[model samples]
Target chain A: MCGIAGRILNAPGRVGNDLVELMDAQEHRGADSTGFAVYGIPRDSGYILRGMGFNKARLDSDLEEFRLLLKEHGSDFLEDPTFVTSDAAHYCARMVISDPKDLAGWVKDADTISDSFEVQSCGRSLEIVKDTGGAVEVADKHGVRDMIGTHGLGHARLATESSVLPNASHPFWARPFSDVAIVHNGQITNYFTWRDRLHRLGYRFLTENDSELIAVWVSHEMSQGLTMEQALKLSIKQIDGVFTYMIARQDGIGFAKDRYAMKPLVVVWQDGEFAAATEEQAVRRIYPGESEVINYDGPSITEIWGVGNRRAAA
Target chain B: MSEIVIDVGQRPIREINEEIQTACKTAKPIVVRNTLSRHNLGIGLPPGVDITFEGSVGYYCAGLNTGATVTVEKNAGWAVAEGMSDGFVTVGGYAGMSCGAAMIGGLIHVKGNSGPRCGVAMKGGNIVVEGKIGYQSGFMSHAGKIIALGGAGESCADALWQGEVWVAGEIDSLGVDVNVVEPTAEEVAEVDAILDPLGLVDTSRNWRKMISGQRLWYFESRDANAWLMI
Candidate 1:
């Protein structure tokens, strides 16, 4: 029970603010959390702006000096993270770039950072920020209300069996690998079997949701130097039961439906542009023009856009 | 007086229904062309209209029919007259399984082989399969006459009541509580009356008639031989 939408434009460069407007219609699909990944690198460095916090007063006073310390070490920090309290209960911050080598180094210094946080530039091609809340709240606070991109993916989670926590919110990004995420619909009945196999391969899992297992499987295959499409095509065979999924890799985005075509995946591709969603209404609401719209049955591969225009491998 | 000619040109059934629903409000017949290999031709016909699907239908062709006459120029799908009431469905080709299943009041004519359970739990109307039928032809027929042109499958007649069954083919086996009985010439004429609309008559002096001994509804065993195995 989630909504996902993404579009690929032929005249790429950057999309302005319309992305948030498109996602706003599907806010009900995910009430617990909201987020988006902009396909650009943040310029400022070392200043990790933690957007939403319960104790703003405490974090304001406590982290002020540490924020200054980062600026003192040839690092420029911007910490005025804004949270759109009216709509979204989230916040966003921009960090300055100082020491280029120490980008990942600051992540290990957990003692200096108060909150349980994470910071890493995935593939140096994408920036990911996700938290618990609705779309308006997240977009208002993160300043994504006016954000746009040529390629991106978003998920609004409807937690069926799992608790509504930050980690459970999608689009789930696989750890230790950047620029790879997955948003899925339908259950993985054979999750345990795959989980056991992944554990044997020294891969760690973050959430109990079966959807997360797919990220690990794909990441493992990618680590072997297999391209994103190659890895996903291979992983589809090992998974059992009905499922329709979309994978956002560093270069491109891929979507797949199960063998039986049990789940739904509607795609509309036209004029060198493509948009897909769980329902036709979602796609129509955004693109709403006459185009060739078709339902994705089982065992079909659609590669909409990628790093260099690679067709989705069947 | 507008004639809507529907030929197979990649138009989905949903699109056709929109036109049919509008035409029914003004009383018109939908003339369908190139119905061969077209699936779900006249499924779930709307009220107050007549639809003549000009060719064979794929699967679940005329299911849940209500207040409409759907005459197929060719064969029909599985469960052709499933749960239909107050309508008439005629198939010129072979029908699959469970024809007129749980039907209330409708008429279904099949010109070819019927798979299995030709009329299961038929409450009203009549189903006449003009060709051979598969096993368990009428497993639990409650009401309705199942006229078979060719032979019947194993267990031809099971536990049935109220309705009548006439099989022209050889019965391989009998189901539980099914009785074979001699039919009077007057009763034979009544069976022939149902086929008059479709113009199918077998007057070769070699017709066999079978009926439930009315024991299913009354629950009495006057005759030791539930089936008159002649």
Candidate 2:
């Protein structure tokens, strides 16, 4: 079992603490790994690189190697990367770099230096911090409670079909698609079939986690000129699974469940903000007000909260 | 019966729940006041106790109740009275989704609007909604009775398996394999017994009853259209 939570605020402010609190409420859902995709203030021409390590020592060495690789590839760092201890067994760092047209290629090349080193996310406004631990502890380690953003997505992963590794953690970033991330609860029955199709289309996958395919598939559809609402509506007919998933992009955050409504998802909208989670307890903790919380069920129930003028499709 | 009034706004949820549990051990009446949308209130209570929330509550209020009588004076969040077995829960105001979901044996009364999947997957229970309910009110239910007095949303009783549904108002649509059946005089009397206490009786309106057709339960090799029915 896994827990997925997301929050979208009408105004730009600090929401990392809200996400951490939300994740802590559903910590029982997952204990193996926890992570979050936070959308902070956007930059014009730089990429935010977030990498994970198995330990502090290895993370320091990997960061050194990553810096050397960036220098070797004629890429200039806009700011020095800062490394921090995420947990007893995990570490992470954030770096801002000048525009590299082949950012995906750069990330793939950086992974070859050490198996313990993995790029969690690379985007203009999104930074993913995740590791193996309790969701609250990991969030505290990454200082997620202090992050300010417009919207974000988080996951508490209980490893069932995969190993307990950072690479297998959720809130998977849709690679090569800036500012796209997804957190899903439920299994994808047709994972390999869809993965193979995307792989044949020259889309690369870093992890074998089935939830990552949702991000890839949705990103593919959005790239094909479909709106986020349209892409999610299409997923209901295509993706075969008993799933409830939430997506966060540069523009908005939205959630969709399978037609069967097999998985549990409760949403609360209050004061122009929306909070969704695998359970209503998590949402109540975030917005402890008198908002009417709705149990999301039925066929193709989609809700989207856009940043500005973008209205919800459902 | 001694009354213990605890203000939920001033105390933690855990403390309030523990106090309620302690009160239930002695079969005392507990009144929880200032419950400003706090989740998980009145959960896992013992039998023969009466607990009342003076204000609105958050999710899972009175969930998993065995035999306690829980009353919320205001609106409730999602999953109100979920998984309840042998108890009575009354919502004085609106109720969120999945009200009385998967109940084994109990009675859940919602005096106002109930959100979607009101009696979903109920094993054995009786739920009465005084106001209109959201879509898919009794989806995938097995062996229970759902009475919606005002009306129900689209696909009112989808995938019903041996359960019974009676709606007095409009049904936007019906789910797959669910069929409306004429209610007998005995069945109408049974419904009257359930709603008479709530001061809501609509004998003039055509009360529709629905049941599962059981078309999706079996497979026939000779039947060509059986696969498409599901």
Candidate 3:
């Protein structure tokens, strides 16, 4: 089991504190790892590179090699990268690349450098920070409470089926697809079948985690001209699992559940703002007063909200 | 009649819950204000205490209650009065999923609609929902009485085992191994007893009682359809 929390503000605002508190509230569901995929203002001509390392020593050297690779690819850093140690086993780094279009190639190259070096997220407006720890510890180490974004999603993973490594953490980026991330609760039964299919279609997978399959599949569908809502609807029929998953993109945030509706997801909306989580307790921490909370009935239920707008489709 | 008031917005939830537990030891009347959808409020309370929550609550409110009377002024999230052995829980507004789930004793009442799986795995006790209920109400029920005044959604009383379900409105469909049976005089009296205390008496609507057909427990070679039903 895992905890998934997400928020969409009608206007662009700092959502870091809210996301942190949300993950904290649902911390009981998963304590193995925690992460966030936050969408902020876009830079004019750069991409934010967030990565995780096995440790501080490895992270420092990995950052150096990453810089050399950027220079080798004719890319320059917008500024000096910042690195922070989350724990003895994990560290996080963030840097801005001068060439935004080269992010995919840069990530592919970076992954080949070392098995321990993993790019968490890279996009114009999206940044992902994840590591093995409690939600509060991860937030404090990464300064998640101070992050500013219009919409975002957070995850706390319990590591039911995989190793408790940084690469196995949630809020997985749809690699090669910019500004898209997903957090999911529940397991996918047909993960191997779908993974093989996507792999046959030229999709490269970095981790063996089943949740990563969702990101790749959704990104693949979107590349084929399907909207996020359409892709999610189609996925409900395709993916065989009792799952509830949330996705955040540059334009909007959305969530859907499997046909069995075995997982729980509660949503609350008031004053053009929306918050959803595995339980209502996390949502209540955001809007603690008179806002009404509604249970999202599953069996192929989907809801979406565009950033800085009240255009919600259910 | 002394009343202890707790403002949850001002005080931490753990502290407030501790105070309630302490108060209930002495059978004190406690009033909690500004609940604001916090979870685990009024859970596992002892007997003979009265508690009132002025606002909404999150998951597992008044769960595992043993003889206390808890009242919510507004809506309640998931699992209200779950696993309760005895007590009375009243929700003024809607309730979320698994309300009165696995309850063994006591009574739970919802004034508005209740989400899915109402009275699921109920061993005993009585549950009454005034408004509509979501799908799979009374799923896997062992024994008890459930009354839905506003009707039930899909698959009402699925896999019911010896429990009594009385619905006043239309049912979307009956679940597996369940059948609508004629309400006997004793059954009608039980429903009347459960509803009379709320000052609600409705004779205009027709009521149906649902129970499980015990044919699925045994395999009979002579009856071919019995194998399919099980």
What clash pairs does model 2 have?
B86-B105
lDDT of 2 by residue, A188-236 (tens): 9899999999989977777778888998898789769998889888899
Q: On DockQ, who's better, 2 or 3?
A: 3
True-structure Cα RMSD, model 3: 3.8
Ranking of predictions according to DockQ: 3, 2, 1
lDDT of candidate 2 over B1-230, digit per residue (tens): 57988788736789988888887777678898867676889899888999999868877999999999999987787789889998889998878878888998889899898877889999988998888877788878898899988888877787778888888888878776788999999999988887787677767968999998897677677754744423
By summed lDDT, the worst window of 10 consecutive residues in model 2 chain A runs over A305-314
How accurate locally, in lDDT, is each candidate? 0.62, 0.81, 0.83
Please estimate how well model 2 matches the true structure, expressed as its whole-model Cα lDDT.
0.81
Q: Which ranking of candidates, highest lDDT first?
A: 3, 2, 1
DockQ by candidate, in order: 0.04, 0.39, 0.46
What digit string (tens of lDDT, one per residue) describes model 1 on residues A112-175? Answer: 4434222322434455556677767666655664543456666666777577765556666655
DockQ, candidate 3, vs. native dimer: 0.46
TM-scores of the models, in the order given: 0.52, 0.86, 0.89
What lDDT score goes with residue B37 in model 1?
37
The candidates' interface RMSDs, in order, read 13.0, 3.3, 1.8
On the 0 to 100 scale, the lDDT of residue A72 in model 3 is: 72
Model 3, span B78-183: residue lDDT tens: 8899999999999999888889999999999999988878899999999999987777788888989889999988778877788877898888877777889989
Model 3 iRMS: 1.8
